[model samples]
Target: MAAPEPATATATSSPRPSMRWRVVDIVIASVLGVAGGLVFVLWNLAYNPVTAPLEAFLPGLQALFHGVWLFPGVLVALIVRKPGAALYGEIVAASASVLISGTEWGPLTLLSGLVQGLGAELVLAILLYKAWGLVPAIVAGAGAGVGMVVLDLIVWYPGAAVEFAMIYAVSGILSGAVFAGLGSWLIMRGLARTGALSRFAAGRELGSRAES
Candidate 1:
């Protein structure tokens, strides 16, 4: 008797458009966004207190935690694997955060979310939304981190010294790369293992790995 064929064919061969967002996509995306937003609220409250020691150690190093705010973009992009997934997820999360918990930046938080989400979205677009591997995920996270620091420089720290700005930007990139990129990828793999994402390629890939 022949062994069972792997279920990775549809993912590898399907055209991009065929991966358009479905109802489930919308539902799951919304859930991720809302949950992420709640996390953002809690993180917001804890941000200054948690980072005070790091800031005292090195003024701009607190940006190391910036990735905490950027996870939804990377996570949603990996899970949804469609155009605007990152933007939609991050934007929704940001908006929800504002509505539910309020943020120091007020409406500007929405803009930050949009731009950060765009950063990851652009990376995914460059990959043609076809790849969900570690490299792409890291790139996407770095992109968001870069976008984040740039926005912060303009809006929150316009008068900050060049050295401070530079440190902030670099720290943000590394943090986003690790926390958002690597973290999201790990979370996705875990979800896949649980069979919660069985309908997605991510889950199928995990299954393929196990069978190998």
Candidate 2:
């Protein structure tokens, strides 16, 4: 009688890492994008009116609201943990906002979305898509904020005073870091706890915690 060879550790381990999006991944990512789009629309509607007082208080302070538009990238990237996830999520979300609710910014909004998504995407790429945590979230949010401000300066705020640009940039960074960064992390944690993300790493981590 012959005996079978023992399985190597490598052979028995999980599959190699992949950037390819599975059907489930696309579905979940699209759902997140659509939800983000709806929020973007509402935020656009309320932005001017809600920030009127702030705009009056400080010309550039209203830029604080910029973070709301940046969240989709961070949230999707963290959840999907895949290449292009941030860009795909943000662009789709932006397109949805425009198609569903319309925006005064017109098609330019799409460009903004592209750039912001790229910002977060760049961060994820830099991290090699190996980490999804508070620090990465904050960095991604801040990166999105930087992309936003650059475009704003060129497209909408050219010739603006240095003080105004600085204020706008700083406000945006802070807002993105707190509202988008921390906010998305909290939301992901909640979703993971609910097991809705069971197939994802974030969900699996929480699932393990429950068992322990």
Worst 10 residues of 1 by lDDT: 11-20
In order of appearance, the predictions have TM-scores of: 0.90, 0.92
Q: How close is candidate 2 to the true structure, as a TM-score?
A: 0.92
Q: In terms of TM-score, how similar is model 1 to the real structure? A: 0.90
Identify the candidate with maximal lDDT: 1
Query: Which runs in model 1 stand beyond 4 Å of their true positions?
Result: 1-17
lDDT of 1 by residue, 31-121 (tens): 9999899999999889999899998998889999999999998998898888899999899899999989765676799999999998888
Query: How much is 184 displaced in model 2, in angstroms?
Result: 1.0
Q: What is the lDDT of residue 80 in candidate 1?
A: 80
lDDT of 2 at 80: 87
- Candidate 2 at 169: error in angstroms? 0.7
Stretches of candidate 2 off by over 4 Å are 1-7, 11-15
